[model samples]
Target: MTAAVFNHEGPWTEEEYLALGETQQRVELFDGSLHVTPAPTPRHQNISGELRAALRAPVREAGLHVLEAVNVRLRPGRIPIPDLVITGPIDFDELNVEAGDVRLVCEIISPSNASTDKVLKMHYYAAAGIEWYLLVEQDSGTMHLYRRRGGHYTEQSVTRPGDLLVLTEPVKATIRPEDLVP
Candidate 1:
């Protein structure tokens, strides 16, 4: 099979960005630019797995789905692969999920992408009309939940390691940040 080759230049169009297909690293499109990020660290993956386990049952009961590191098309020229997402039913053949189908988007923050997750993605998710935003800080074992209010988000709760994060919207689930890591 032949490899796909393209110019490594900026101002990439949506079709051009999608043409890169599945890559070894995470690639996202933002404002006509392609942003490439390395894969998550082991600790990050562990936390993500734990959180997924915690939310699985509850989300399933609500007839929703929880996915990890999937392409979410927020709008034209904007697609991000969130750490975790709670979404409605999706077809198996689809390349990406639309923002409307996504009820919640979670980001496990590491030192490398702290600012991007906390600020940039936060703004984009909110503007996309995704109802819930979850931020998990890998270093501190802290979780922050936000709910969309108009075109922005309002912090609903912040739970630390020892405390339990009780969520009702999108799905009903309780998670303890401390349990996210071994």
Candidate 2:
């Protein structure tokens, strides 16, 4: 992953922003700038919804909490709202599960976000010590799996719609790219 230049719009404190009490907005803090994510595309939304649905049973049985588009505070004041997040042994009082509690982070690559997803976000997630990262690219109808290795990510596998996504940690579950396609 290449280094991302710090070019941000502005700063946002968690307190001031969380008080807004709004929903369905994807807000992130990149290099101290507030990056507001656009409403997901139809395909992106569908894929995320399906992936969340598929993981529900397994995660619940394992006594894990699954959240959609929740702010994960990667650093002191930097948070990135991942598409789907699975965390373990939670204390509901604090939802801001830092990069450590993150078991798996999934991203349904939007058309415009493909580069950010593959490059910048990939770099951040790896640096943050996320264990597993899954990317579903709609245009090519493929899923790329990555596993963190000593502060970096190694491409585990790239599978098409019909192939199953296998992971070693969190739980034994299968992900089909077709289930994630719009």
Candidate 3:
């Protein structure tokens, strides 16, 4: 694995970011700046795990790849580590997957970084042509599912704990929001 660039002072290029060493804490690049975020809380992991479990079977059956907490390199200076990401076959020895290689990207909104997940990262995902973006809210098990169209992500469904999320765009998976909560 390449070192995660650890600079937040000024804007840095993606090459510069990748050449840097990794940090003990989880780090990500956004708009040429490095942002260090703490490891996921137990609650966050629970939610992420549940969602990953739910999608794994279907994704695999469809011959797609799913991973958690991996880097989606949208472009230079705009690399975001989504909580969960589903994409096509990935090459070995590749440090990061390009956004274009992604079919779907999911983020379990971290309370400390909800805004970035909702706004900045969402914009980056959309611009990169990722077709699906699943936003998981831990506490309520609410999901704001999105699909890219016209260069933006629009809500495909707003599902709650009681509702089943049926997705057909990126893949076919029937998921329950409550099942994703810890």
By lDDT, who's the top model here?
Answer: 1
When 1 and 2 are scored with TM-score, the better candidate is: 1
Candidate 2 local accuracy as lDDT?
0.77
lDDT of 3 by residue, 1-182 (tens): 22334323567778776776565667788886678888899999999888989988999988998899877789767887899998888884687898888999998888899998999889889999999999989798899999999789999899997899998856799998878786
Which residue pairs in candidate 2 collide? Answer: none
Q: Best TM-score goes to which candidate?
A: 1
Candidate 3 — what's its lDDT?
Answer: 0.84
**What lDDT is reached at residue 27 by model 1?**
88
lDDT of 2 by residue, 1-182 (tens): 01121332346566644544444557676765666677888878788888888888888888787778877878876778888889887666775777888898988888777888888888999999898888888765588888999988998899886677775568667877777776
Q: How accurate locally is residue 56 in candidate 1, as Cα lDDT from 0 to 100? A: 96
Task: Tell me each candidate's RMSD, in Å, in order.
Answer: 2.1, 5.4, 2.7
Better model by lDDT, 1 or 3? Answer: 1
lDDT of each: 0.90, 0.77, 0.84
